[model samples]
Target: MALDPQAKALLDMVYRVGAPRFHELDVAQARHSFEKLQFALRPEMPAVASVTDVPIPQARAADGVIMARLYRPLSAGPDEILPLTFYFHGGGWCIGNITSHDVLCRELANHSKAAVLSVDYRLAPEHPFPAAVDDALRAVQWSLANAGMLGIDPTRFALAGDSAGGTLSAVTALAQRNAQGPRAALQLLIYPSTDILSQRPSRREFANGYMLDTGSLTWFFEKYLPEEDDWQDWRASPIRAARFDGLPPALIITAGCDPLSDDCKAYGEVLREAGVPVEMLEFEGMVHGFITLGKFFSQANEAVLQAGEALGRAFAAGGAS
Candidate 1:
C-alpha cells in the first residue's frame, strides 16, 4: 500500500524540521524529543472518572519501586469492580513513560470501559536488559495481588502496550501463563518488536524513510541490550520463545509501513499455529508510532476504538483462564 497521505505529511514535516533523529541524541535528549512529539501531536485527553498514581513495590530490595498511573473510565461507577488492562508505554524500552502515554490510557479506559494501569517501568542505558522485563513482571504481579484494594477485577485482567511496551506485555503474559495463579485474559500488542533478531522484509523495506528508522532502532537496541547475547532471550524477543501455546488470546495491531510490521504478523501466526486465538489488524499505509498521534492521524482514533472494543468483548466473554 502507498503511504497514507497524513503519514506522508507527517514524515515530510519531520524531515523539514531538520531536528536530530533519536540515533543522534543522548538518552536524555532522545527522551525529551520523544516527549515533545507526543505532547505536540497527541489528541486532547479524554475525560476519565479517576486517575491515580500507585507505587508498586519492587521484588528486589535494591530496585526501589515502580510507579504506575491508573485510569478509571467515566462510565465506571466509583465502587464498580471493572476489568483492568496493564499498559506499558513504548519507547524502545528506554524513552517513554506513563506521562507520555497518559492521554492514550485515558482514551483506552473510556473506550474499553475498563480501568487502565500505565506502568512506568525502568528505562534502559541506565538499567539495561532484563531490568524493564523485571519491572514489567513485578508490576503485574503486584497489581494482581492488590486487585481488590485497587477496585479492579482480577479475573478479567489483561495486558497491553505499543512497540517495546507491547513486547513487554507479551513477555509478561507469557511469564504469567506458566506460573501458578492468575493469567492474563488478553494480550494487545501494537506494532510490537517481538523479535530483536528479525530480518524481515518490512525491516528492510521501511528501514530509512519511516518514522522509526533503522538507525534509531539500532540506537535503542544498543542502549537496551549492551550485551548482544541478551537479544536472544525470550524475555527480550518473545518471538524467540520455544512455544506460544497456553498464552492468552491476542489482538495484534500492525502499521503497514512500520519496520516491525512483519514481526507483529509473524508473532500472530505463531500464536495461531499454537492454537491460541489471534485477531490481527493492519492499518495499511500508516507509519510506526502513528497510533499515539491522533491529532495528526485519523486512523489513530479508529485504531484505539477498535482496540477498546476488542478489549470490551474479551472482558464480556469473561476472559480466558
Candidate 2:
C-alpha cells in the first residue's frame, strides 16, 4: 500500500525543509532534531487526572537516577489502585525522553483508564547496550515492589513501548520469564524491531523515503550495541532467543509501510507458536512512528484508541479477550 495521504504530506514537508538525517548528525544534534520534529508533530497535551515525576535508582547508579513519569486519568479515584502500563519511549534507545512522549502517554492513560508509567531510561553511546535493558528491568521491579506508593495495582501490570521502546518491552518480558519475576499481563509492541540480524523484505522495500530509513536504523543500532557480537544476544534481539514460551500475551502493532513491519509479524508468529496468545494489528498505508503524530495522522488517533481498548480487555478480570 502507498503511504497514507497525511503521512506522505508530512514526509514531503520534512524533505522540503531539508531536515538532517539521523545518520548525518552527531548524537547531540540528532537528539535536538528528533525532539524538535516530535514537538512539531504532537498535538496539544490531553487532560489527565494527574502527571507526576518519580526517581528510580538503577542497579549501580553512582549519583545518577532514572526518571519516571506517571500519568493518571480523571476517572481514577484518589484512593483507588489502578492497573499500570509501564511505557518506554522510542528513539532507537539513542534519543527520545519522557517529554517527547508525554502527550501520547497521557492519551493512553486517559483512554485506558489505567495509570501509565513512562520510563526515561539511560540513552546510548554514553550508556550503551545492556544499560538500557538493565534500567528497563529495574524499573519494572521497582514498580511492582513499590506499587502501593505509586497507586498501582501490582497484580494488573502491562508493558508498553514503541520502536526501540517496544524492543525493550519484549526483552524485559523475556528477562522476567527467565528469572520467574513479575509477569506482565500484556506486552504492547508498536512497529518494533525484533531481529537485529535478519534483514527482512520490508527493510529493503521501505528502506528509503520512509521516515525511518535503513541507514538511520544502522546508526541507532551502532549507538546502542556495546560490541558487534552483542547484536545476536537475546537481550539485544529477542528474535534470537531460543524460546519464546512463557512470555506475556502480546498486542503487536505494525505499520504497513514500516521497514520493521516484517520484523513485528515474524515475532508475533514466533510468540503464537510458543503458545503465547498474540493479537497483531497492521495499519495499512501508515508509516513508522505515525502513532506519535496524531495531530497530522488520523490513523494515529485510531491506533491509540485501539491500543486503549486492548489494554482495557487485557486488564479486565479473567484475562485476555
Task: State the number of backbone clashes in model 2.
Answer: 0
Task: Return the TM-score for candidate 2, rounded to 2 decimals.
Answer: 0.97
**Estimated TM-score for each candidate:** 0.98, 0.97
- Indicate the worst ten consecutive residues by lDDT in candidate 1: 176-185
Q: Which candidate number has the best lDDT?
A: 1
Q: Which stretches of candidate 1 lie over 4 Å from their true place?
A: none
Clashing pairs in 1: none
What are the lDDT figures for the candidates, one per model?
0.92, 0.90
- What is the TM-score of candidate 1? 0.98
Most accurate candidate by TM-score: 1
Off by over 4 Å in 2: 61-63, 318-321
